[model samples]
Target: MTKEHILPKWMREEFPELAREPVFQGSQNEHDGPTPDGPRTVYRGGKEESGPFNRQAPVVCGPCNNGWMSQLETNVHEPLSRMIRGLPTVLTSERQAVVALWSAKTLMVAYRAPHFGPRPRPEVILPVDAERLYQDRALGPMMVMGLANYQPTPYAREPLYVQSFTRMEHEGGAYSYCATLRIGHFAAQLVRCPDGMYPPLGQIPPHLVLLRPGASAVHWPPSRPIRAGAEWDSFVNLPEETGT
Candidate 1:
């Protein structure tokens, strides 16, 4: 397995001011409550239970994890981190593609976490498949990606969030998988199944301020005015399926 730094090096490089800030990682804590099925591990930010928490995930293979995946991180880190830090920036269509690739990579690693709970069973796509997918510039029919914004509460501690989830879909499908990675108040949503298979995250609780990349424009510090039918919108108003 390869060593993966949860917080990519580009984070500090892009935002030098935050270089000295403490970075927190999520750790899988022991399963506590009894469940009908069995015990499942609990998840908490590493800072919650320990003094020093190194941000690392060592389960991915070296070549695949460090090579192409690392490249993806490098390409997207600046824009994604800026989005997370609530900094002013614009995400072009190409930039959006990079962010989607990085988001998928992050979700794949998080899937290895013991406490990551149940998700829609993912299709096994090998490293070679990744190259093929990348070249094609698509995550296939099973995956969908979108962006969103939110205003963080004063007490919010974690700047990043990564997890997988499933929904009882609108159709007959019982488990439609979805994954999300949020940095600061910006998030990239990836659904591993087709639209209409499940209700989109925007349609659910904690509705998000969704971002439409090509159709809309993004300006940080929310006070900046965005044009009508643009990138930023209430989830309820967006199309059911919007992503590359």
Candidate 2:
């Protein structure tokens, strides 16, 4: 039981709408379910659980979980949630960074989950830049982020589905390791590479818009009432025929 890292009081003040955010008090062990990996799966929500960060999983540790990260959650919550609730959103670089950081944080915690057991394979696990993220509250220089919308399940309770996978890309005489996260209607991909080896967002297979660091905002969903599925895999494994 992680008692020390409770949700901070300041969060409620910053995002009062959080009061409406539904909290799932289901048995953690019962709620324990298999999380999707490339083709296999790993169990999440077991003996120990952290959470309710704005009613989402607070899967990181004390200092790494609150304050700084909380601010990122706050900045993007409204826009992201509104987009999920069927509204137009202008995703700015700043907000996109929030998506990247939050996705990376989720991956970081997943990497540390006990169910992965002793000595999980290194390639499947994300090399999280937690120290850099905690210190600066920003994506490390090597990381790039992007986003897109997908069809949703009709009238489903707000779902905060998030999934990540690691990939190796060869560039600039080295491999650029990256991770992509699918969260609800949007997917945020973060790539960390050696200096000068970073690839731009356009290289990603999905027709995602580049969440360029420090770039201007762009109106997303280019269409109205964007819908998303209930599961993370729905977005991650979206058919190639679908548009972003």
Candidate 3:
């Protein structure tokens, strides 16, 4: 297997400010259980760390890393750079697809990274999902994507940050896998659910520009912005009932 950088090299070179800044990686697992008042979420063990933003995981094969994955990064370089810099730009339906695909790929790589502690951490994206992604090189219908502008407070700003979580519904045996990624002013979230299951409507914050298969062009800097710190924390950690 070849080592792949979770945060692409181009990103670091383009925004040199991020080269030395620490990146915080964290994961949480939420479960539905009975509480005195009602059913509540039981959060279990999780890991958190702050270290150099440049991280690599030896999880991808040489062909995949050098072939399609590299192409995907190339395809998104220009548009994503603009968005991360908070520059004005329009994301047409086509561009949205590329961004969504790249987001999914990144999330998958992050999930496989060693920072999450060890095995048996909640599995959000299934093995089959990753295989399908590799074969199709596109987002499947089971995945939903959204993008938004992040307004970080001076004290909380970081070059890169990611939070991943899985929500389990005991009654229905349903699972939701989600990850929120932020790079400078650009933020995106991807949710994956089983067939016939959908993410709760309330799970998504209203300010995001939902990226769909055939949707129209979306303007940058959505009307509502996610303020860093509390708002961002809340967005990354969804409520128990929201199915993330």
Judged by lDDT, which candidate is best? Answer: 3
lDDT of 3 by residue, 179-239 (tens): 7888778888887775677655465456787876467898887888898778887777656
State each model's CA lDDT, in order. 0.49, 0.48, 0.74
Off by over 4 Å in 3: 34-41, 44-53, 119-121, 155-159, 198-206, 242-244
Candidate 2 residues 1-244, lDDT tens each? 2322223344355445544553321111111113322233332222322233443333566664445656666666677666544466777777766656666665555445443234323343334566677567667777765566655566775534334444332322333444554434555555566556555545444445666657787666544222454443433332221111
Which lDDT value does model 1 have at 29? 25
Q: Order of all candidates by lDDT, from best down to worst?
A: 3, 1, 2
What value does the lDDT take at residue 122 in candidate 1?
A: 30
Best by TM-score: 3
Q: Write the number of the candidate with greater TM-score, choosing between 2 and 3.
A: 3
TM-score of each: 0.57, 0.56, 0.86
Residue 12 displacement in candidate 2 (angstroms): 13
Candidate 1 backbone collisions, by pair: 142-192, 212-231, 216-230, 216-231
lDDT of 3 at 114: 75
Model 3 weakest 10-residue run by lDDT: 43-52
